[model samples]
Target: MEPRSHKLYHLHGFHSRNLLDTYCSSKAEMPFTYEAFMYPMEKFHNAFSSGDFRGDVLIDFSIGPQIQHLYAAQEHFRDIILLKPTEHCILEVKKWTDSRTGAFDWSHTTTLATELAGKSDQSEEKEIRLRAAIKHVVKFDLNQENLTGSIGLPQADCLVFWNILEAISKDLKEFVRNFRKFSKLLKPGGRIMHYGALNCTFYMVGGEKFHFFKYNESDFRSMLSNEGFVITHLEVSQRKAESDLMDFDSVMFCTAYKE
Candidate 1:
């Protein structure tokens, strides 16, 4: 049965507790918010290691404090920039990036990544590499025409986006608009690596409602193409269990290059 009957709640805010305790946690710990993310993470790892998407700069246009997507790009990019939309998220990411006191644990993710790479659970080494690879974690507002005007940042060679467009957008047009703005920050012919929830409309974060635009694989591909992108790789993981924490049919992963 659906948790809370998948009831609708007015979209109000982003909850840190929800983000840390559920969405970012592993399926073993958070079956409701996370559903087997390691599969997509492994796919991304293979795609980046194939030598087709290496770059000098890789920008993480993330909505929350997600770093799993970067596990693949660390070897493929020289510098990594993490962009957050809210102060809370920025602080959350800083807690991990700066190795601050009482940071949210990502040990499971580290272990999973190492195992996927054919290594024997070298989580400490993986964590060290991830910390060394991150160059900056800064605030970024998608509503702005100049995303990082204050810092005067250069365009990125590749952008990693996940769990943002749908969670915050109320409609498809807004999704496209925000997507175009983010794409503009990429250099010509640069690539975009994306992860999205499919057929999700609303989700709960710390008992507060967060909205998601309903969309499927077709909608996503069409939107990417409309914005001058060619998808080179795509994968989707069908949801295995139902929960009140999040209502999504599947998770989608894709790599696309601007035309």
Candidate 2:
């Protein structure tokens, strides 16, 4: 079914707790949010440990105020350069890094990540390490020629993106153009990992509906291939529960390297 047209909202308010309740809260029947946090951490740890790619810097192009996506990155890379599309995201990411009082508690997710990586009781230390490892949190606009604005930084060894596509892009052509910008920021043969909602129209946060560019698995594969990325691994997980809060059927994650 085609999603009805409506006034799309940007994450202007970017209500942190409301977002947690929508996706991260454990009260929901389906573990969609939990799984979204888990699989990426697992894949990152496994991929790096198995000699997939390791380098000094990794650029994170994920959305929202979340940090669970960076669990394994601290161990593998010396620096994590985050690119944020909004002020709210920059503030939220820095809140956790600065140990601010109102920051969302990510301890549970951190503990789970360590356990999945074959370690126990290391969550606290892992959190500390992540804070130290993040070197830059730069504001970015996908529409700009330089996505990071005036800041000049070294090309990263890997670019990791999460849920960014369905949020900012209104269509496939725009998505393709923005994707090429990401490629330019990475070194030749650098790896890429993208985790995004599949076939989604809009997701609700703070009771506001935000329309997004909707696409499926085929579009995802073709885009990566056409953009000169060699697909190394691709996986999809069904959301597995129904809710009015969101209408996505599944999530898509893939690992690739620029060819």
Candidate 3:
């Protein structure tokens, strides 16, 4: 593990909240920078509203308790499994999944989703739908052969992860290894959809800096191709959040199917 790996810190000690509020906020001192990220997310999730990629089960490899990215998937995937690295992240997901108190309020994101889908005033229904769609939140480890301990999880129809690669992977080899492992969780024609930051060296959480993998577009395209995946869709946005909270030059959204 690298010296700055997030494994060195306690996730419950404000990492989740700090990561979200910093990058997810559009009202920050450098709002344009944050707004740059919002574009890809809004555009990406909105595409899920259509049924082009509906599936029986979808796995979400979330870096933290991020529910905003799962809203559009709710209407498409009947069963969703959320994979978190720590117990704290798992509990945070369950809190919102069960509608418990103090769960991070993602209502604004829900509102944005509904509005984008041209279904304004449907935030409550959308939230309820996502809560029900999430069937389980399991602790996961990419380094393990099985990832989810010994649980024999069924191969999913689709797997979608957001930025977890940069958070956990220490180097290029590990990043490639992660994709190899992720392939085993899918059926023959199953696809992997992802959103990742580009050219990011590090990001701050609760005032603590952690390692963030520095990679770019060609790296992903080459990695996916060599790792038995055929790139189908890819879009990258230049860095907009010009804040010191994180140093990412761009963000990437990609979809690839196992070959």
Candidate 4:
């Protein structure tokens, strides 16, 4: 017999969990606000679940455990990089644990960007732009961590970094640094997609507040070009069935590739 019920449950799980989490955890703190994390978390999960690329290696910076869940459920098991210890948790526990004492290592940003760009296909202008677009985004950054030992995979065909750029507080320099890190994660001819909000605010584990970097279509496209990515698909839509929880017009979805 066809496993009709199994298929149905799998299909409904994303929306059901998203809705339930949102309603149940609205008043909770950073990680506890399940909807805030699950919405984007599921989006990224669904993308991999679609199985279009079935990447040889998937590096998810800052979202290790979420990806681990998806990997466990799916048969397509690629090497995964859960950058830093924070990948295992909803909040940056390392940063919180050493908030007063921890020092930020800014060099990793440039190093990662250079690495991703180096691995990308380098054709003429248009081709290069197209590839980079598939690789990087306006707000998010991808960085390399010392997790290669844990992931135990070779070089990745696709690198997926989740929820890095969305938390940047200040300094355009910091933003640029993150952009570079994201750009370097992709191998040549690999693809990248990022999910970011228009205008949103939330609190973290340490009671620190973070907001999205306000961006429109023009600004977004410009950032892509600056990072040497060609914009393939950019979509903006309002959140359905929900009031303005964060005082924003819409959510931005971007998909691009590295050349």
lDDT of each: 0.76, 0.77, 0.75, 0.41
Candidate 4 wrong stretches, greater than 4 Å: 1-46, 49-52, 63-65, 68-77, 85-154, 169-173, 201-208, 240-248
TM-score of model 1 relative to the true fold?
A: 0.90
Model 3, span 12-114: residue lDDT tens:
3345666666656445463443343457557557557545567899998866778777777888888999878787777877888888988777776787878
Say what the RMSD of model 4 is: 17.2
Candidate 4 has an lDDT of 0.41
By lDDT, is 2 or 3 better? 2
Q: Flag the better candidate by lDDT, 1 or 2.
A: 2
Q: 172-197, model 1: which lDDT tens digit per residue? A: 88778878877887999999888877
- Per-residue lDDT for 1-259 in model 4, tens only? 1222111111121232232233223343323233333344345445555665466555555321232122221234334444433222323223322333432221222232223335323223322232232221111212335223333344556555444454442334555666665556567776666665555443222222234444556666677778777666667666542443334455565666665
Q: Which candidate leads in TM-score? A: 2
* 174: Cα error in model 1, Å: 0.5
Clashing residue pairs, candidate 2? none
Per-candidate TM-score against the hidden true structure: 0.90, 0.91, 0.90, 0.51
Distance from true location, Cα of 234 in model 2, Å: 0.8
Q: What is the C-alpha RMSD of each candidate to the true structure, in Å?
A: 3.5, 2.3, 2.7, 17.2
Q: In model 4, where is the ten-residue run with the lowest total lDDT?
A: 5-14
User: What TM-score would you give candidate 3 relative to the actual structure?
Assistant: 0.90
Q: What lDDT does candidate 1 reach at residue 229? A: 97
53: Cα error in model 4, Å: 2.1
